[model samples]
Target chain A: MFSWILLSDKKVHQAVADTVHAVTDSSAHAVAEHGAHGGDENLFTQLLHHIYDSKYLEIPFYHNPDPNKHGFELMQFEKWYGIDFSITKHVFFMWLASAVLILVLSWVARKNLKNRVPKGFGNLVEVFVVFVRDEIVLPNMGKGGLKYLPYLLTNFFFILVMNLLGLIPYGASATGNVSVTAGLAIIAFIMIQLSAIRAQGFGHYLAHLTGGVHWALWPIMIPIEVLGLFTKPFALCIRLFANMTGGHIVILALIGLIFVFKSLAVAPVSVTFALGIYMLELFVAFLQAYIFTMLTSLFMGLGMQMESHGHRH
Target chain B: MKNEENNAAGMIRSVAPYLTLGIQIAAAVVLFLFVGKYADDVLGTKPWLMVAGIVVGFAGGMIHFFREVVALSNKEEHERITKN
Candidate 1:
């Protein structure tokens, strides 16, 4: 058994090193292991706890194995409808992300009172604003999308910040949580439906659910279409959750390679590869935020376009 | 309110088709399969209905897939021709 592991060590390392698999679907195994690995408080389990939402914030420059001694516990906030409502680290990080953005937008970003042009941070902020306006909102959604720009812009920056939080020291990524992503998806879904309803009217919206099919097939078609309506945002929720989670999985798996081999020789190589994956995680942070925003606008556009153009290819 | 990444999104616009196509294909099958499973639970046919659901779902999913592929290819070809 040890001989096989030794022989295939380099080969398995190559597989984990590829990281494309790790960056995508393989992250699920990382999450699935959370349930399967309840016994030991090994490295993988610790990594899972760090990535997963918990009731306490991990304090900087501190390490504690005992659950009770570790981090500032927000504890349970409230319980409604059988679900435990707790203000955990993920929630704290999300709020922190929002607060930081709020400060940047409100006070620190305003350096252009005297000059016509926005200077420094404000200028940097302007570039993104114009880019989103001209490139994303106008192109995909057109003038009609201008009304929804505030929501779309908030969606973009909020998600971008949340994605970035995980990369920073002692910060948890709220977007990695399915529940957080689901909440965002739900808002996006509402906006998409609102776009369709506003453009097409109430009666047309209901009629469209029939899929222009005969009344006899309405039972099948309506349910299918409604499910289809949900699946778009559902796709958004799952993609963000999985991509972020997958990144964590790849990192854990690479770190796990050392424990698997039980060798000090693997440490340098494993750490190097883990560092590379970390860089990729940074790119993914932005990519995911972009994908979510672009897709949301595209869906909103498609919603309005459905009626005006009569069909989409 | 701040710099978002619509500009970057333009650079990666081509990536969208790749993401959506698989989901479109799978979604049809999954949704149909779900309806079939619910029906099976009520009707007590268990495996038989689920088996039928799988077949139907695959057929339905494939049709959607082919149609989407054709449309995408046609659009791509049109763009290639028009670019020249």
Candidate 2:
């Protein structure tokens, strides 16, 4: 049973095994001195706690139980980030995804740099990189946006990688977390504002608060425009966070239907919906990356235009 | 009444930018205040750091707003010169 559960991911199991060995070492010493092998009990109990109760367990959010076994169980968020944030399961997955992305991208990047025709994975990555730079970054952001292309490219690919990671069986999605999306949105917001400031001088930037209207109309229009700017990024954060989380929740709910109905009869129905949603999520993953990059570029263009106007008169 | 309407229209047009400025200032202030208040309560800070946060956020927002306006003006000037 333990070995089967650990089969979900080998590294996770090894890490758990290491932790299990560490905790059971002192206890194992006492148990061994007694000339009994019952230390297995202590090991088992520790493993169970780690699996079910410990913060370190990375249980799949969408789990369905067999009717042959004891019923269904819902994955709990409170158990993960709340009282048990120390659990390295989510953190480990995040690190693993990031490392794998960096290693793979770098490897592909180096191999394709020769002055010859690129093929295979190198070709795919190059096409993606160029498309984002030319299509997404350049058009919306205008010519001046080239300076910020690297950041936008990293953001898009990083998000794309993380989103695709969750699509892998048993892999957890980091992008589903509000904190992660909010952090990304906040960074984009900082970039947007800084670019604006850099283009326009100190005095003129504040003057934009009034929508570049003459002084007499400053009272009413300023607040609305200001709110508009802040709300744009706030909406971006919420949209990404909500969409990612909502998909996972729907999948979980669908699986739970079989357990609720107490029959395998629902499996056929549930699987169809699950597959359909799974496909939709793949598209959504790309759509979100595109939207975020496009918006950032658009904001950059607007800022540049504002800056150029500021110096005119 | 007609005079007041014209004044309101003129005010609407001119004060628009300042109003936006105030809003940007206010949003930054409110965001800081909300976060500071939450943190102070959660972290057990005495006297609540929200007041200081609001002041700091407002000042920062003003700086940001001024910078944006200047950038816009500069871009406009470049465009005009190119057109000529």
Highest DockQ scorer = 1
Candidate 2: clashing residue pairs, number: 56
Candidate 2 per-residue lDDT, tens place, A1-313, comes to 3553334333433443344334422222222222122223343333222222222333433223553321123333445544744434445556676797789888987889873677998898889889888766665556778888888888888778777776775455677777778888999888888888777766777766666556664543465456657775787788887877777666655643433333344557986897799899999988887777767766666666665443333
Each model's TM-score for chain A is: 0.82, 0.70
- Locate the minimum summed-lDDT window of 10 residues in model 2 chain A: A26-35
- How do the predictions measure up, each by TM-score? 0.75, 0.59
> For candidate 2, lDDT tens digit of each residue in B1-84?
123225433343223333344456667677767767887898788445877767766765675567657754565476468766
lDDT of each: 0.73, 0.61
i-RMS of candidate 2 = 11.4
Q: Is the docking of candidate 1 incorrect, acceptable, medium or high quality?
A: incorrect
After the best TM-score superposition of candidate 2, give how far the Cα of residue A200 lies from its true spot, in angstroms.
2.2
State residue A179's C-alpha deviation in candidate 1, in Å. Answer: 1.0
C-alpha DockQ of every model? 0.13, 0.07
Q: State which candidate has the highest lDDT.
A: 1
How far does residue A61 in candidate 1 sit from its true spot (Å)? 3.9
lDDT of 1 by residue, A137-163 (tens): 987777889999999889989999999
